[model samples]
Target chain A: MAMLTDLLVISAANRIIGLIRDVFVALDPDTAQAVEVLLYFLVMVLYAILCELLLNGQTLGKRIFKLRVVDASGLRLEPSQVIIRNLLRLVDGLPMFYLLGGITCLLNTRMQRLGDIAASTVVVRIPEVSHPDLDNVLGSKYNSLLEHRHLCARLRQRVTPEVAAIALEALTRRDRLDPVARLKVFAGLAAHFRELVDFPAAATESLGDEQYVRNVVEILYRAG
Target chain B: MLIDLPRFVNAERPHWQALEAILKRFENDPDLRLPIDEAQRFHYLYQRTGSALSRISTFASEPELKQYLEWLVSRAYSIIHGQAERRRFHPWRWFTVTLPTTFRRRIQAFQMSLALTVLGALFGVIALAIDPEAKSALMPFSHLTGRPSERVAQENADRGKRLEGRKTTFSASLMTHNTKVAIFTMGLGISYGLGTIVLLFYNGVILGAVAFDYVMDGQTIFLLGWLLPHGVIEIPAILLGGQAGFIIAHALIGWGDRRITRAQRIREAAPDIVTIIAGAGVFLIWAGIVEAFFSQYHEPVVPYGIKIAFGCVEFAGLIFFLWKGGANSEQNNSSKA
Candidate 1:
């Protein structure tokens, strides 16, 4: 879109300049060429400036890809930063393709191009409409399990977020497991959680391996 | 008692779907007003989703469902916490103030760049004078002119021809070409500045040889008239590109201070680098126009003496700009601020 606008600006300006020069000064061939070069340069530079200013750092292509240009530090995007980055685009889009820019992105932790590095800006993938399955399982935000204070206190001391993630993964992907695999997995998890604290025998007595995992998850993540 | 998983999922599906609808509404248009009741419902559903994500780990819930809630919550969190305000653009302040200030601050880097280029040019002149056949392994510009100045001189005498007065690429194409070459000088400098080193040397070599060609043909005075019309600005612009390239190479090689990471150094150097290179690109645009329209007016349209005189003025103007332009502005800025 930037290039398109640049092209339009150049054509429009050229025609207007031509009309005035012809009517007044009678542009020689040399003068006409000079005017063309000047207009092309102005349009090339201004296209980027105008597009970024109007669209908040999103050009036509960026908008199409659902990518947004934002400050890396999460500060509001500043015009100076935008100008710096857009100027550096000449460097990033080099050697026929974005080969240099691509290599830079691969090397940098934030995947920044030269312009991005200069501007302290990043191109982020906008978050999209997400799936609905989580609401079904964690229904109505009620964690009655929290009301069981003794069990909750025990669970907290035993479970870390990472370990709980493992338990969650195993349970959610249970259908993918072999019957024998499921039994061994749950048994190992039950042993792991049990080792964290010496819970009363009453909590363990009625629960099998799978039920033990579920009860532990409920206790660990219950709403406050 | 063990819960019937499928039965529970059936009963819970509507609430999950409803929560998704609310989050989507907010995500689609962050400023879209939500009534008080709907807002409370959205918050309630968000909390429920968070709780489900935690417990579903052990519930044998579908993996896809878990992923869905994870994404939804993360999206919601970003929307709530992230600053997404549209930025107001200020073209005047940035170009006039910030850019010049950076240019002034990076004077030393540009000096280093100038020193390197002069060294390369000296290398080209001396090496070619000694052995025209002695070619650097990487010499792309040599084909334009270099080494066999005697041969080019002979051809020029025999044909009574020179590239002077000959039209080159169209004005726009020439500007584009110059811009690409200058930008590449800065970009490829990342290879420990080696690419920049070679390219600069190669350019100087080509230039030295071209001069040799004209001189051997006994057209030194005329060539000066032709080249200086645009070279006054064009040469400096290319040199500015070389300076920017060296700055990038220095950042990559960790020649800079170690208090900051290499990335941070690049960030610091970038404004100055951009200021010079952008200036270079703008210069090339003017150079292209001159080469197309004025530089060619050497023999007939304009006298050679006057063209040479015009070139001298352009060169003197350039010298004044570079010598004092950045320094004066920096002083002015400090005083103003």
Candidate 2:
């Protein structure tokens, strides 16, 4: 994100300077030619200083990518830290194309550029999120196993939480699976449950693989 | 009666949704402020979501709810803990402490660059002495054609003067030019340091040949007077660039700790690499000022001895400061830092 903004700032400055130079060349060629390099350097320095100060730890590019500059402790980024990092950015930008900074970033576990290390700042990813609907997975209420509340309690004691969650997810996602896949998934889940609990043969005799899974979900979540 | 799964979800779903809502707002706007009630509720919901995740992961059949809560909790954690109101520090400390310390760490790389420049200069001088008529080949006259060097040499031969009133403008341009060169030298270390070496050697050869050219032309006094003032500062500035370049090269080649990846070691040394480059930049600017205004304009007006003496002083001061200025405490704090 930071790199993109830097490019924009540099190119914009160049265009503005180029226009002024054209005017100067027509008016005072010598003066314009002499100050060209100086003008560009000053603009570049000012660009770096102003962008960091005004943006509050985010460059135009950084904001676009949802990456923010923060202190190492995951706290607020300090202005000094920002300066240190940016100052070092010149070094990182050496030989063109941030090759030095890129190498450093790839090496470090934190993915910090040269500036990031000196300033004790980190670039963190701020992910976009939304509310997830629960109706599809939690809508069902009927449970044939409700008659065996005591048995459900025993099953809960025997089945660990991890095993129960897996069973529920498979059952919720049952309709999405192909018939062959559905049967295989249920068989594996049933075998896993059977290992955890020794249910009576009479309870299981008539139950298909999907029905057996449904009964397990009922016993775990619906039965008291 | 069967335990009502929907009823259980009904009780907890509002909390999860509320948490999600506040976190979503923060994600969109990091600086956004929530109402006092919402702020406290946000924290409360985060805690609830954490507990709910463990619970759902254990007993609940609603995997999606557990997943939702987990995502909300993590986002909340990033916001609540990361929204730090920034503090300020002394900027001077960065140059005084951090920069010098970092440069000091890579002293070996600087030395290597210095050696290359010096060797190149010696080679040029030797090559020129072996054949005085080699001036055309030795000097970069092809590049100098119509450039400032050609004009400056012509004027100096006539009136022993050049760049009289345009010193500031020229210095500014030279400063920019030198800085670019220095930075380029430091940055090219990634190419196995090959580019850096070639640049340093090429620059050294130019300086050496130029020195020999002035000697042969009987302009030795004028050349010394011209180059010393700025060369004292400028030469070291370029050398520092070479040092920084070599530092990058060192990192690339994996100078230490085979157990860790080469890139990791380079990251560890990134601070030093930048510090050296920055210090070099400062010197280059100073050198440019001396070159455009002081050195080039000093001849006839300023005695050659005075000019050379001034150059020597600047050079000696640089060496002293680089070697001894912050050595005492750096030795003690080196490992800790």
Candidate 3:
């Protein structure tokens, strides 16, 4: 998708170059042709270099794909790295399209093409995280699990933070889940939490699996 | 370790934010340097943020918060730990000093490049002498494959009128094409120098075949006049490209030193490789202009002696520049030390 978008952009730039060439061609044919060829190659080569340099290692394609080129050694991207890598498109784009690059990427552990290997850079997905509204997810509704103080304390102690976090995430994103998926997920969570501690029948019997998880999260998060 | 998560975040958030802002400034301007006090402060913030991350990493219930802290620590870590020098660029210093210094440092590779080309040229001369028909295959261009005397007659008769209107376009094409070839030749180093060797030898073969063809046809003056002006610079530029390729190959093969890994060796040589290739590119551009505007014109229009003299002068200048251009600076630095 990024390659397509970049190609489209290059095509549009070529059209503009053509228009500019027409004006020059009327005055000096040789100069016009020279300008056209120079401009064409410049646009093709500089597209990635300029974008990666100015945009913090993100080209238009990389931006669209939510990917960024970063130094494999976790250093700032140097100008030399950007230039050397882009110049290497000559080899990476061998035979036809990026067949050589693609195969190299697949075979390599870090999935770096020849350019990336030479430049010491890697393309990484920019992870996006949505902060959950803790207040809304764990509202003031009375938590039945909290009624049995001893069992609630044990549940909190036994449930690893990872499990507790997963439960919170499910509750926070519950509205976006499919009905069947929601039921299955909540059922699984409730079963896992139940095995951690034995809450009396009265505390959990009236609560549904989803509500039971809501009660468990409140106990884990809110101290009595 | 089981501290209050809310209080912990409240206490550390400001430091994390401070580190992020500093990192942003560093990333935006690579050449930016901080005062000693500010540098100390930056280090403090990084350490504090890293500590917070360790604390939060264990209590991983707040996935989003942990992710944010991890991101901050990572960005800070890179800024602090990167080993590549980030000095501000000075084009004059690079062209006169750094470029020559790097070339001289890798002189052996350049010699290897020269040897390979010479070897290939010898092969071409021998093969063509054995079978004259091989000229068609050896020098494939239509203009080149024909009899040299006929071509010289044609060039002298036309006196560059054939290229009168298209010189600029021709120059641009040459610059772009040669620059592309130079870069590709350097890049092929990743193929363990095998590809670079093949390309350099192939170029030499073409050069040898053409030289032999002209000499045999008794058009040596015309041939030298035509090739010398541009070939002096252009051939060396390509050799520089080959030199870079061999540098990369040497680093890959570890150069018989296992104290460092292949990656470290490549990383160490990368800056020099770029420097040599860029120098080659600059040379090729000049060669291109010369080839189009000056080399193409022949005897009656522009004398062969003048062209040959110009080429010799250019070659001498190039050798002197490579050998001693940066020597003064080296002496000053050593004396100061």
> Number of the top candidate by TM-score?
3
List ranges where model 1 is wrong by over 4 Å. A1-135, A138-147, A153-158, A197-199, A221-223, B1-104, B132-169, B250-256, B259-264, B326-329
Question: What are the per-residue Cα lDDT tens digits for candidate 1 across B274-312?
Answer: 666777787888888787667755554466788788889
lDDT of 3 by residue, B199-243 (tens): 999988888888988999999999889999999999999999999
Indicate the worst ten consecutive residues by lDDT in candidate 3 chain A.
A149-158
Could you report the DockQ of all the candidates, in the order they appear?
0.10, 0.17, 0.47
- The lDDT ranking, best first, is 3, 2, 1
Which of candidates 1 and 3 reaches a greater DockQ? 3
- Under the 3 Å rule for N, CA and C atoms, how many clashes does model 2 have? 5
Estimate the Cα RMSD of every predicted model relative to the unseen true structure: 9.8, 8.3, 2.9
Q: Which ten residues in a row have the lowest lDDT in candidate 1 chain B?
A: B160-169
User: Pick by DockQ: which candidate is best?
Assistant: 3
Cα-lDDT of candidate 2: 0.70
Clashing residue pairs, candidate 3? none
Write one digit per residue (lDDT tens) for candidate 1, span A1-224. 43354456557766776675455435355445545555555565566666665676666656666666766755445554576666666667666566768788999998888777756778776555443343333445334344456655546544665777688778778879999999999999989888876566755676678777776665544322
lDDT comparison, 2 vs 3, better candidate: 3
